[model samples]
Target: MDINIERLKSTLMELSKFGYREDDKGIYRPGFSEADFAARKWLMSIAEQEGFITRMDGVGNVIIEYHAEDVAPDTPAVMIGSHLDSVPAGGMFDGTLGVIAGLECIRTLKAQNIKLAKPIWVIGTSEEEGRFGGMIGAQALTGKLTPHQILTSHDPDGIMLSDAMRSQGLEPMEALSARLNPNLIDSFFELHIEQGPVLDQTGVQIGVVEGISGVFKWIVKLIGKADHAGTAPMEMRSDAFMGLADFAYQINRIIAEDGTDTTRITVGKAELKPGFAHTIAGEVDFTIVARDMDETVMENLAASCRKALSAIARKHKLMFEYEQVSWLTPMKCTPSIVEFIAQQAQKLKLNYQVMPSGAGHDSQFFTDITDTGLIFIPSINGISHAPDEWSHWHDVQAGTELLYQCVLTKAVNKN
Candidate 1:
């Protein structure tokens, strides 16, 4: 079955209007914003028009179910979905494309009058961007996030996540019930734009993701005594800023020795206390983000960071503290499902390759409970989370078709 490109484009264009930005290149709707609410309403309306039953879970995940009358109720449902939330000033096609593409896949199946033993569900998972550190709404559905986490998380404006959910008519406490009984879902699939230049650079139209990378985030703090910058001798001063500088330098050295093309460590955010040009810095705080496809490598890098901190503290006569902010284990896509997707790509005569995802996705969370797979279409220049990000309409259409093929195959084969 082939997706209707015209309809798919029209749907994307319509969705774009909700968070429309004249100066920015793509949409700008953050989670739980008024614009986000409007987009969800629009999606629900579309799902209803397609004769699908629409429901939103407690954490604001939208599920549109297409029932097969001839199928047995006990049969596992084939699920296809992605998140709807966008990063701050993100492009239009990042998370939204996967979701709309999933819906389009079902639309194609319905147009062809295809009947299957298992029902199909297209989902729009919430907050995959971690705007509030809640990923894909999967945390709630998978028991990875607690009500306390939701109640405690706040956006930039200090609007608590619980309040945001309440504003959208969702009960935060009830979000725990959103967890899917592990037996209900048979297999999960997500179609996404590559958000990187890999496929576009290689001229591949599709990507069958082998696995998603693990992520480790830390806040490293260096504490030292504050003193007069001019009066203090350079040799006698215990400068926190200097200590942090040396720490960052050592991190670079470690990365140089152990880092590969896929390994990455970033000190993205930093701060120095006692806002004064002449005052000796008393404390320095910085964040570290480390990612790798292999969990062992990730763990080793974390250990290296601790060693670096200890050595730096001993040299600088400063106290060091390393606080772990977050850690997500790597998840590999199911081999059978990945092979099935590759087979469909070949059958369609589409150019494709197997690859690993450098970024996290909602699919990773689903892997804890169900067999899951991911597909990626090219993102022009491999740019995402920015307005300049662009993916050709043809690529989106190709991805949607591949998604349909995979879903259909899984539904019929029950593997």
Candidate 2:
């Protein structure tokens, strides 16, 4: 059955208002913020009003499920959704689209009086914007969360995760209780905006994601003596910023030698200590985030980065140190599910591409636990995480329709 794009659009627009700002016309629902929590509660309330069974998990994931009378007990459920939270000043469609699309799928099924052999659950996962470590809700549901992470995690502002949870009336350690038995879930599906230029540039209507890239983050420090900018001889002074600049310049060469076409390395954050126009920078602290789909390539890239930094430090007469913050191995979507999604796309007469997602998503966490599929619609100008991020309504409908078709096939009894 086809999805109602108008209904989906209306719900999306209504949800966007929860964190919208007039200043920049952006949404500010960082994970576990007041806006994020309000959006979750609103979703649960809306689902309940529509005659669906809805509840919020301990970690704040909003679940709306459909279990008809004919569906047998102990049957596995088809869980479909994405995270509900967004980056600060993020666009409206980033993670919210997946959650809302899943909701629309359920609505369409109910309106058509479709009978189910299995239960279908639409979840709006919490804290996926990395304010206190991203994909918190998904990690909890898939049994990937650790008590250490829950207690020690903090945002960029130094607010602890436990404190954030308690502020929202949720106990910290209780997140562990949100995990579900792997067997209890039949499969998972997520429909999301491509958030990149590939599909949009290629004029493809759908993207059947094959895998997600592995990522590693490093916090690097380069230390040197602070000296008077004018008096310090250019040859004698040890400049930390020079070391950092040299490393940045080597990134392209590193990738060309040790990385693939898909490999990406970014120095996203940086700081110079003893900031003054008359003083040379005494220290430079920067972050290195690298991504690649292959584990070995990730290893090679990391090694090259370390080598480059060591050489740069020696050349600049600076001390070098780095901490490996986090490393997530690449994950592949279920082969069967990937093929199934492409086959369904062909049946729908939609142009499709099988590609890897450069960005992380909640579905990556479910790869080992159940069959998982991720559908992607084009993002206008390959933009996301900003107010300008957008996907056309027709693309949204097509992606949602594909999700619905897959869910119907899996949730309905074939007998």
Cα deviation of 359 in candidate 1 (Å)?
A: 1.2
Q: TM-score each candidate.
A: 0.87, 0.93
lDDT of 1 by residue, 237-342 (tens): 7789888788777866777776656787888667888858999998888778888888888988998889888888888789999767567788899888889899
Top lDDT hit: 2
The list of candidate 1 runs beyond 4 A from truth reads 23-26, 134-136, 151-160, 219-248, 258-260, 270-286, 310-322, 412-415
Clash tally, candidates in order: 2, 0
Model 1 scores a C-alpha lDDT of 0.83
Q: Candidate 2 clash total?
A: 0
Question: By TM-score, who's the top model here?
Answer: 2
Model 2 TM: 0.93
